[model samples]
Target: MMESTSLYLSPTIFFPNYQNMLNSFKIYMYTPPNPLSFSSPTESLFFSSLRTSPFVTQNPEEAHLFFVPFSSNLSTRSIARFVRDLKLDFPYWNRTLGADHFYASCAGLGYESDRSLVELKKNSVQISCFPAPEGKFVPHKDITLPPLERVTHASHAPGNRTARYLGFARYNGVKESNLLNELRNDSDFLIESQPSDGMTLVGRLGSSGFCLFEYGADISGIGEALRFGCVPVVITDRPMQDLPLIDVIRWQKIAVFVGSSGGVKEVKRALDRTCKDDECEGLRRLGVAASQHFVWNEMPQPYDSFHMLMYQLWLRRHSIRYARREFV
Candidate 1:
């Protein structure tokens, strides 16, 4: 089925000032005193997107926010050191004490609450993929990046499928437990530890009514299922807010998240509820619509991942005080 545009799911519904944000929102990007290596694909995308967008401002005095771009895999202490150098070299850091600064990182952050980096971690806004402290990242202060590869289009549509459920990818740690031992003999489930000769991974996802995922374990799989128009039945202990733009996107509409602590029967019950009630069609449509939010474009499109990130930055513009300079 072809999916219709969902106006209610649009970010503008919550952020009515998006147009004004385009006109006025200005970010001052700090060129590091030393060269930085952007090792991860996620960091490279964010670095390029911010530079190409109109939100960047050359003049720091009039800027609403400051962006301090860094590379992946850097120790949190290294980041704090980088911030320390900025404080000595630039006047802006002293005025706000890095309160108005932000960075996008794929590296895990907030694990170490080092005394020196406390200001940067607690005061500055962190946009991260592996946001720490488990289940939910702190909102109104931080944004979780959609961990994804670059995609230009979404063309998949929901259709008749052969399997009731498909486990199309390997779990992060397979030794933890064998999934659905009770259904090992069942044909309705196409569960595999890895790909077999029957069909391609993408093919399996497309032909299945629902996909299973262990959220926070293999999050990229969630992106894949959405792109394929398969209603994702996620088994996770994580909060719904752990997802990108969950406050506005209504992830519950597109996906079902079951707690991992629940036994095998719980998984069967959830899947039965979705398929037997005839809700997969609507769920698939909304899941397809949500695919747009996980995509990264060179130039941000409305409600795309980059644009959604900008909305988060816009919401956090007031976290720090921007003071005016005075001359005697």
Candidate 2:
């Protein structure tokens, strides 16, 4: 008789939009819209506990394993950041790190609309981590955008229209803009300063740090305004899919995503579009479904508990463990 051997599984191919894919998963787990609390015991477990059987005395191994795993070592917020960032490695991780395994991370509530998560879930293959209290720094570094400054050049200006884009970066697909020219021409369009006297905010911002830009509003503040029923507008060269908004916010409804070519006119166009769209009116009709689905409130969701289940699944399916190994 000959002995048989099996090869360990290879890693999954990485995708550029891996984060987007994961966002979809997070959206799914968050769907049907339920309130989440970072402090909830069931939410933290990510898996149902094995209860004692009537006659069986043996401890159940099933409860010890799950498809997604939560962290005992990190808080829900930290874990949430970890998963959001790890999306870049999805393809590689999916195949080799282990099979049929997932991790549920968590992050602070009130960062963005959880409803956005639901939208993503309906379309992608990723998952959201656990939930946490609102207001904390994400585990990953903030995406840097050009700082707003008074333009001295002639090309950076436009008449009465300020050209503003947040989180602009060449690598991330933002086109190089002539800020000076835009400012010079748009004298009527002032770059809204961070402490704007009366301007409205438009996007999510990183927590616990001095803001990167000098004017207008931070991303978080923008999301806050949206929650309060104020429509927000964001300018970017890349897709808003990665931002705190996206599927949940509805492009022309409640918010706007401005592309590089879209200038002040674009903002107005977005605003105009938002006012006419009737799709979102039904959001109010969903009742608690609309309110709870994918919307994060003061409380966090069951992200961590879900991640723990993933971790357990990885261990059992692949004979691996999380965070117990080290190299000297």
Q: Please tell me which predicted candidate would have the highest lDDT against the true structure.
A: 1
Point out the worst 10-residue segment of candidate 2 by lDDT. 1-10
Ten residues in a row with the worst lDDT in model 1?
Answer: 1-10
Tens-digit per-residue lDDT, 114-152, candidate 2: 322322222222323321222322322111111111211
- What's the true lDDT of residue 5 in model 1? 38
lDDT per residue (tens digit) for residues 240-279 in model 1:
5556775457676788778756666777678678766567
Q: Which pairs clash inside model 1?
A: none
TM-score of each prediction: 0.81, 0.32
Q: Model 1, which residues run further than 4 Å from truth?
A: 1-12, 111-116, 130-139, 150-154, 158-169, 172-176, 180-186, 193-199, 238-240, 275-277, 320-328
